[model samples]
Target: MIDPTGRPPAEATGPRRAARPERLEGLVVGLVANPKKNAEQFLDAVGDLLAAEHGIADVVRTRKTSITDPIPPATLDELAQRCDVVLIGVGDCGSCSAAAVADGIAFEAAGVPAAVICTDAFRVSADAMARLQGSPGYAYVTTAHPVAPLDEAGVRERARQALSDVLELLVQAPVPVAAR
Candidate 1:
């Protein structure tokens, strides 16, 4: 079978995750927004929290042209060049969830630590995508589902609740499965 994700023959390997930063202070962050409903707002809220809580120096934000497709290589390259880390999000549906996970893996392959956020409803799809992409235990954050219907305050609340997990995914090294 042809592996479209470009995984090596080894089944246990995927994109090598970037090294975690010792501190969040002064580091540039990238936010890759999927064009799904309320995705930009959700990302904005998360960016605000990261800036407020972690002292991130700046955020370089970009919106993908399509929610169901992988991020364009040029955009991914730009983010990798300009940002220390990246957060991709608001994957509320199946296709977007898979795309987000793929984008996160691509960022990691570019040597940027990435945190991918999805709604709880799409967790199965996100996890499956990770495995398909050769990252069986890739870490991603999930918020409560149905983000499209949430008002600004509601979305921010979800962001607030997901903030800690976001921070952990960005700054902390993932423990090996064997260690867990």
Candidate 2:
């Protein structure tokens, strides 16, 4: 069953007994970069990291039209149908970051695994994660931040860590068989 966080309960049995495996074979990784200059750079680095470090199968990158509104319906659908997981980077702006997090939640509801990367200074990553976790529209929310000054390596590392954490949680959590 779907939880308030919008994730299905853990699956039953075998190596995947506790949580789903990091099943990236044929999985598409969606990158949602905020329309800030640094955002694209960060996302590109993240895409490279996923491809190089984790060997993700495919990467699809898109940007939100505006920071305040939800991602466009077409974009959401594209990601949902083609992607196994999505990563969103919220630049330095808090409002924009929150909106992106909300958008990620919506994407999760559409059945794409999603995570958000916040600015390290804001410390809102955890709060955003909690908000998504408590909401009915998103079930598996995870957060990370690149150390400021925004270097490629930092962005890539943070992205890798956040994606890794989300996959681990998915693999570890008990899939709820019935609605809670």
Candidate 3:
């Protein structure tokens, strides 16, 4: 279950912490687009919705060259420092969703609150959330399922919902201090 880095699959659960009030001023949304052609379009729509609905302060976007690979480590580290919370969308690829969740957890480990939105059509947003809750890497994971295939309208709604859930969780979860 553990990857080479000693991180386990995201489905493994850990002890819950007491909820804490969110101290973030504004949210930073991280969008991970699948390599598919429509990935960028979907991410843009999601970003626009987060801005309009959730008052997100900034949006950071990254695209993977392939579903099998992880996003660049530099990109993940940059996002962790710049954003209090990160939103990763898989663009309807379950395989990519798994990879993206791993990347999001890396962000969390570095002190950023992160949630991964599973874009797989077979799994509902709620299901994704459940899976993430159990995942070791994404102990703080959240999910958003679009009404249908990702389009401008669907992406907007889904992104808004996903961002809202992530913000709520981040506000409640205790902030982990950086190790000395």
All candidates: CA RMSD (Å): 4.2, 8.6, 6.9
lDDT of 3 by residue, 1-180 (tens): 223223344545642333333644466666767676455665577567667765778887777777646667788777767766665655355555556655655665667665555644624332443345464323434434433455666655555566555555556755568642
lDDT, each prediction: 0.86, 0.59, 0.56
Give a tens-digit lDDT track for model 2, residues 1-180.
112233343332211112234555556788888776567666677667667766788888888767556677888898878877777766456556656656666665676666666665544633453344445333333334434455766766666665665455333355578955
Name the regions of candidate 1 deviating beyond 4 angstroms.
Answer: 1-15, 173-180
Listed in order, each prediction's TM-score against the native is 0.88, 0.65, 0.63
TM-score of 1: 0.88
- Report residue 140 deviation for candidate 3 (angstroms): 7.4
Give the poorly placed runs of model 3, Cα more than 4 Å off.
Answer: 1-25, 120-149, 160-163, 173-180
Number of the candidate with higher TM-score, 1 or 3: 1
Instruction: Summing lDDT over every window of 10 consecutive residues in candidate 3, give the lowest-scoring window.
Output: 1-10
Model 2 alpha-carbon miss at residue 160, Å:
5.5
Cα error, candidate 1, residue 50 (Å): 1.3
Position 145, candidate 2: lDDT: 43
